[model samples]
Target: MTTTKPRPTGSSGSADDADATYEHHLTADEQKWIDKKKYAWIFSIVPAAIPLIIWGVAEWMKAIDAPVFFAHASWFLGPIAVFILIPIGDFVLGRDGENAPEEFVPQLEETKYYRIVSYLYFPVMLASLILCCWQWKYGGMEWYDKLGLAWSMGMTSGIGIVAAHELGHKKTGFERWLAKIVLAVPAYGHFYVEHNKGHHVKVATPEDPVSSRMGENAYTYLLRSIPRQIPRAWNVEKTRLARSKKGQFNLDNDVWNAWLITIVLWVALVIGFGIGILPYMVIQAVIGIALLEFVNYLEHYGLLRQKLEDGRYERCSPEHSWNSDNLTTNIFLYQLQRHSDHHANPTRRYQSLRSDVFAPELPAGYATMIAAAAMPPVWFAIMDRRLMQYYNYDIERANLHPSKAAKLRKKWNRVAAKQQQTVKAG
Candidate 1:
């Protein structure tokens, strides 16, 4: 059921309008895509905005002389809102599968308004981080309160990585640089390099650190991803610098230069806010980057690209990535769940990224999937069968965890044999 939206303002014509060469009236579904993403992009800031919400709630609780748990729980609200509430919204609101009409796509891509919406993330994120640092040290809050705040701030930076991911994909220098800067807060500056240079190229292959294999838990993937990503990122930049006759240690290297930003920011925060904030910084960074990698783990979990006759992996297609239509998560992650389209047209802005029906689908949005990924048994129960179904129950087609491969093959063999026998008995 496609609801007809008013065509985006400032448009000369829309799909709703009848044109000279057109044969018939356009249905509401076929109309020019309304720029719902215009305002939805702002929702990504909710994690960063957690402190403001906390302040308002805290003041109200003080006025009412509410229990101490109110203050503690207020800080905890960030996690609840992000993981619990937002996912609820995803289910209730249903899917956002809209795409800009072919005729409208060029104009949609050219629109600068869309670009500006994403750029707003930086200041809001910076303010949230600094304010949280001050409050953690001097706000007269309990130790538990500080931990909640730090974790909440970690969620902010964690989600901010998604913002950086959006900006990083743009061809412009300023946006790319901003991506590096945003990542500095989480000490994941290497993501900008490795993601663009390394992961995208080898995505859904046996080799990609960012892509999770069948039967691999998110914890194992994170353990593998966090350490490997740095050297991977460094190696990418090192090769680039070598081509230009530059030293790896110099500011010209994107890897080191980005790390320099992290070092400077951390040192300044430590000096300004006292060394107690150091542990908070670590707490936040770990949580933040862990959240980022968790997204990575689920995005292409158990999907694989078949190798071609030449022994090169086939070009990545919509089939290689998992896609979701969970509306709230889509808006929160800047349509990242419509990942197949982004990979198909890497430079396409989020506003213009289309949803492909052919892509592999996730059973639910990020929050649900992230939770499942944490517990390997639950994840395997839900995803492994679905993955095998996607490949016609063929284990050979999967990018599998080395340790789990033999067991998985034997298990599936039995399942297939039983199914065949059942058919014969019938």
Candidate 2:
């Protein structure tokens, strides 16, 4: 319900001023809807900022001769915030149902302020990573503190990837390259190619390894998704190169080149710090990539796009993607919780992404759901029932694990049939 004046199109320093022209056409009510989440998007930087704040606290604690345990505990505030505090914020702040109408998208998209908010994350995140590395090498910190720092960096890098996701989806070459650059922090630069080329195209279908299968646990998912995504991304670039008769051995291959950035970054950090810094880097990369996968797993779990008579999978609709509108997660993630609209318009700016209330909605925002996904029994206990209801107990419609398909189909199809019979009798 909060409101602000409708910013003149291109007034916020958008580069393409000619396209938008210096004008405002929206009525007062429409302007209010557009501005509701405008400032909220700035919170996307909080994840990237957490490490720097933690570093400052640790430094302050040291200066004060604070208890060693208190100093060490500060390192864990990053994970505590991501996994614990953010979820609580979702419950407390509740859902955001605003969807700026289609007429407003062009002006909303041209608002450069939103992009600038995301643009801040990279430098802040890199500074945080560098500081964390320095502490690991030169601060004489204990092993537990280093371990905590690694997880903290991982959590930040994981959120950095979310910013990268926003950047990667833009039509501009600059944003795309920024996505690759940010992804290098977690050694996950391949995500740039695979996510845009592979996952988006194959999402919610059986062929997509990145899209979690109905019965797959997060632990097993790491084995399935990680091994497959790298090669798939490579192949996508390779196929593109092949069309022009260029081989993948050269730097023209995006996957190899992007990874080279990762190699150079890690090597530079190792050379500057000690070789001992390598293990913490590895730890952060593992946890960072795991965090990214956890989000991927829940985004499209159990949703299957039906195949047409022509044998092509039906186009991905809102029905195929899970949506959540918890205000806290929405703001921190650039409204990524409004995922159905994202899949529909992949290159749409985050501030303009719409909510589809009728789409299959996650029971809670991704912050809470990802924690549930980490525990298989908990994930299934929460999501399976909702997924069944989405498909109206027709397990045949779900994107199920091959191993569990028969058993699930037998049980759920019977329930569906019983419901049909009861409806007929009524």
Candidate number achieving the greatest lDDT relative to the actual structure: 2
- The parts of candidate 1 lying over 4 Å away from their true place are 1-32, 420-426
Tens digit per residue, CA lDDT, model 2, 268-370 = 9888997999999999888898888899889989888779899999667777788899999998988888888898789999988888755788989898999
Model 2, CA-based lDDT: 0.86
- Encode model 1's per-residue lDDT on 287-362: one tens digit a residue: 8888888889989988888888899997677788888988899888888898888887788888788787768889
Clashes of each: 0, 0
TM-score, cand. 2 vs. native: 0.91
Ten-residue region with minimum lDDT total, candidate 1: 5-14
Error of 1 at 95 (Å): 1.0
Error of 2 at 11 (Å): 40
Residue 143 of model 1 has an lDDT of 82
Q: What residue pairs clash in candidate 2, if any at all?
A: none
